[model samples]
Target: MPTTAVDPYLDGNFAPVRKEITTDNLQVVGQLPPDLAGMFVRNGPNPQWPPIGKYHWFDGDGMLHGVQISDGKASYRNRYVQTRGWKIEHEAGKAIWSGFLEAPQMDNPHGAYKNTGNTALIWHAGQILALNEGGVPHAIKLPELGTIGEYTYNGKLVSAFTAHPKVDPVTGEMMFFGYSFMPPYLQYSIVSAAGELLQTVPIDIPQPVMMHDFAITENYTIFMDLPLTLSAERAHRGEPLLMFESDRPSRFGIVPRLGNNNNIRWFESSPCYVFHTLNAYEAGDEVVLIASRMSSTSVLVSEDNQLDPDANIPRLHQWRFNLKTGTVREQQLDDVAAEFPRVNENFLGQKTRYGYVGKLANNPLPLFDGVIKYDLSSGTSQTHQFGEGRYGGEAVFAPRPGATNEDDGWLITFVYDEGSGTSELVVVNAQDITSEPVARVIIPQRVPYGFHGTWVSEEQLTINY
Candidate 1:
């Protein structure tokens, strides 16, 4: 590995490489958890209560579900599970109340566009709302222009407002990084959880760019920079922003969370083909930014205006950066094309950091995937294979509070089986990554691909809100 002021890029393979993993070999330990194990799939009665507390996925079919896992299986429910309609004001000094209307059913609506990928639904003020693609309201409410109302129940008029907000879990504040289709620029704003504007920080970074994802800590907002060409080409043909790469130096920048919009620190490097995931977790006194970077062929542009991308996409880089120390390290993994990195910790016996990396296969479909355990101190990793042509998403590790570290906790993954042409939401024992998945629940329908998700704690489950 080459070492430099920044981290060195190296050549040798850092870990073992394999071609495929088999799911049949994986052992199924126990029955799925009670909430998920049941045969009866239920939805609504109470319109006031929020849907299932766990992570809910929008399949773009007007079909949304809150997924829960226990004993190795997952169960899902619709967004209308607990929806009550809104009240509309009328002329005769009266109001008209409507009932909960069933959410629209579509055929994989979101997959046509990547906007509804991981981290799509946000839990705010006791309600989990799915933001519509762009500012068009989907599962949530939309207010009319100039009028401010306390609630947005029906499609009727309410307070005019901006939509699809990302709220801070710790502070309970709604936020957004503004996106536009015309000029293709990125903007930022902060709002109240109720969709009221508190601040709009217009930090005009550059043009013709789109924000695939953004990360926020208590102190700052981090945005990954990418080329506008990907979206531009598709726009001409009336399509969603698709794949296009640029040779320009890729950059990552940060600014104070509530400070002036102009305050930003920019750092450039080889283009990150994809910022697969961005997470901020508190490590002692510092907030660390861990990003998984994939190489892009867009970095070989000439001053003479060449159109073709460079020969090959470079190796993947896992980066760690400190906002306070201004330090960044890029670690290169040998043979392993790391993607879908999920961070979690086991606090029972020893407080240790753990991450699961989805390793890609060499096959044409690239369906072969493996799970890796990343040790923070040693900076080394290990892998557990599930099988050939089987792709896994961010693994969710659920441990009972105070359970000993030696006792492997429950690990959940959304596995895609190519042969079945469907996906299974499975759970396993975290301690034994190679062990057979304990509970495997075959989803009734095929789910489209998506991004980040979180497990809602049991204490938060209820429909009263």
Candidate 2:
């Protein structure tokens, strides 16, 4: 069989949905809560051309889908982020550069390595930015989703930005770091509430690792230098990347927010990897980090996804890094096979009682069949399964306007019905996870399974952009 046809990521729900669409009034199944006025936006890859070689899930142009909710009504729109790579390919009418699974098309005159801004979408400091860790973020004005072009923090960002950035809910400051395959392997940066690039500090690491996400306390920032390092040898051989190094120590770098780079304390953990973090905060003498941990990043099942009960699957885990003793303690939070953990945006960087995750299984297709609401206090949980043949994305918690309690809001996600080939914006009441949706804004077209998403309130979106 040909290589392109054999790639699973491009064939199922991961397949690109190329149509750019806008619908003013979307169909709704139930009443859209009056106070639930915000936008649920998600980012995912949608390639413009067939790959010059085999394509990875992350190696494609970005497209953002947004469902705007206001006054019991909903609307939908999607636009591709016009990154440098997208524009170059647009003019060429074909794929010029071979992607992750193939050698780079070095002869192309554009000299463009794919900065497919398709990883995450974050709205902060009044700006909504489409992000891919490979390059600087592309700022787009929404409700329009039009690309306003690359944002370099006034040219302060010299390295690639991570897809996962933490916006300090209390201070309104954004904390982020970038890792590269080249020298100055890791860099930490902070953006002010006013959207100014305040600082960029280069932190030394032994090697370049796929540090997908990090954590923060009031006084310090955390870094994960796991073992899944990018392989130059594999790239030279045109093989799949992110080669795991078993002999390499899985280390975490802890740095004070504004302290000296020389003060970074590195702690060693058992070899493992974290794709996303649930939340983190300071607790007494320790900084607690909650994230989904897997024994390995490698897939354990066959292409047909035969279930392996013995397969080492990802489960929610908690890691406590003692600030005083420099000791690290770890424990698993849940046994469910899950990924894509989230917390209420307002509770970010603080101790919270609730966290949510999407459940996964060994399957040929990427399917998150249900969402779990975990109670951090009692170790209890409630689940909301999108019935059989139905799937959902990472659900974001939207706090009710002027609400007091942390869970007093709604959980929103994009649900795609496999049988019908259509998607819907399902709004689950956060307080009652197992309850029926308060509203279902139906999307006629399939919103392909993607990565991260967020809930942005209307208050922040006062102006277009």
Candidate 3:
């Protein structure tokens, strides 16, 4: 008898939690910040049933783990984003659709692929949207984490929405783009502060690629045309659906916030991929972009993908695009391996001095044993280790009320202890990243490793809900 090989993504902390738990008065290791009044919600994949075929980490269904704090008290809750596929699988009692690792199942009753809303979250126009770039946004209610059904902006959003959208802190507007596998591959849209879908413009690209995220500045939006090409012909030929072409040059398109394809300018850079961006801003004639840059990646496929295993680790990098001179200058800001970079939401789309990122571990799988705070101005960084055998995901900055300093806030994330088989929400002072946690709210259940998250303040919740 032969033993079955275990998929690393489905084992240990990467595994899913079956229970949907809601508990109040969570035990806190230290005093919860009296001023930290908000909910920290992180979104990631949690498949409802065993997958139909070879499963990728990105194929799992969407689940949300949220910790709410008010008046020095804390509560915790978790729920699955009830998508159409989830509901169908719930009724069918098993997975019907295949994942990204397998070829398309055109004969299935449901679509070929499941729209796992497991990527990221955004709060805009009084609604919390659980986003997956493959499909439309699902509106989720806070506190309880209930799905409010799919939000289409009154039939205006006929295409897939980007998981990463930019909400201008000053303009009170949201800017996002959607990519498709078909022609007319890219579209950009903006929503009013009041939540109305204002405009949608088509942007031209040579081919469809898996563009996970982009960047924004106060005056412009930046799109990366990387070499991660998506091909339907290759799928039909029974090959990997995605391929990383190192021979192809990476293109960065700069478009005015309200401009169309004709007004966009393109800049070329060495072939690379950027999964997440820290921030971007305008400085005189240059547009600055800070992000985690990778020389190549094996995220979707490995065999014949032409990826450098050692070069796959993303590092803090910066690129300066000169609009006046049409020349681009790029540099590696830090040598440390990290990803899931975030800045203070209030300072997004503008020049900021500080950033928060998850420091990657030495393990074969994707894991963060610590968090790093980078001082971009001085090129110095501080790390907050989660102790031994502990790991965490993205760290979101929660700005203190009435605080003016850029680092005057809290960095909140879910930390899972492999030694104890338990998880807890850790809160640290943004000013002192190396210090002990301000508080740790021990979760009643374990939280699986996931992707991006956001901090929704009490003021925003009060106005929205």
All candidates' TM-scores? Answer: 0.61, 0.94, 0.98
Which digits, one per residue and each the tens of the lDDT, describe model 2 over residues 270-334? 88878898988899998888999977665411222323343346799999999799899999988
The CA lDDT at 396 in model 1 is 55
lDDT of each: 0.45, 0.84, 0.92
Provide the global lDDT of candidate 1 against the true structure: 0.45
Clashing pairs in 3: none
**Candidate numbers sorted by TM-score from highest down:** 3, 2, 1
Sorting all predicted structures by lDDT, with the top scorer first, yields: 3, 2, 1
Count backbone clashes in candidate 2. Answer: 2
Candidate 3 lDDT over 1-465, as tens digits, reads: 999998888899999999998999999999988999999999999988988778899999999999999999899999999999899999999998988877788888787767889999999989999999999999999878999999999999967899999999999899999998997889889999899999999899999998989988998999999999999898789777898888999899999998989999999999999999999999999999999999988778845446386557899999999999999999999888999999998999899999999999998788998999999889899999999999999999999999999999999999999999999999999999999999999999999999989999998888655
Name every residue pair that clashes in candidate 2.
141-465, 142-465
lDDT by residue (tens digit), candidate 1, 1-465: 986342011111111111111122222345665543211111111112122221122221122334544344444433321111111111212212221121112242322122221134444554444433333233332110111223333433222223334456556676566565444256676656554556655555565554545666666666666553434555467543434455576666777777654688765656555544435544554445554555543222211233444222223344555656766656664446666655443221122356666666664222337667766557777777767757766565566444655334666666677677666666666677777776776665443334444444454333213
What would the TM-score be for candidate 3 when compared with the true structure?
Answer: 0.98
Clash count, one per candidate? 21, 2, 0
Q: After superposition, how far is residue 119 of candidate 1 from its true place, in Å?
A: 7.1
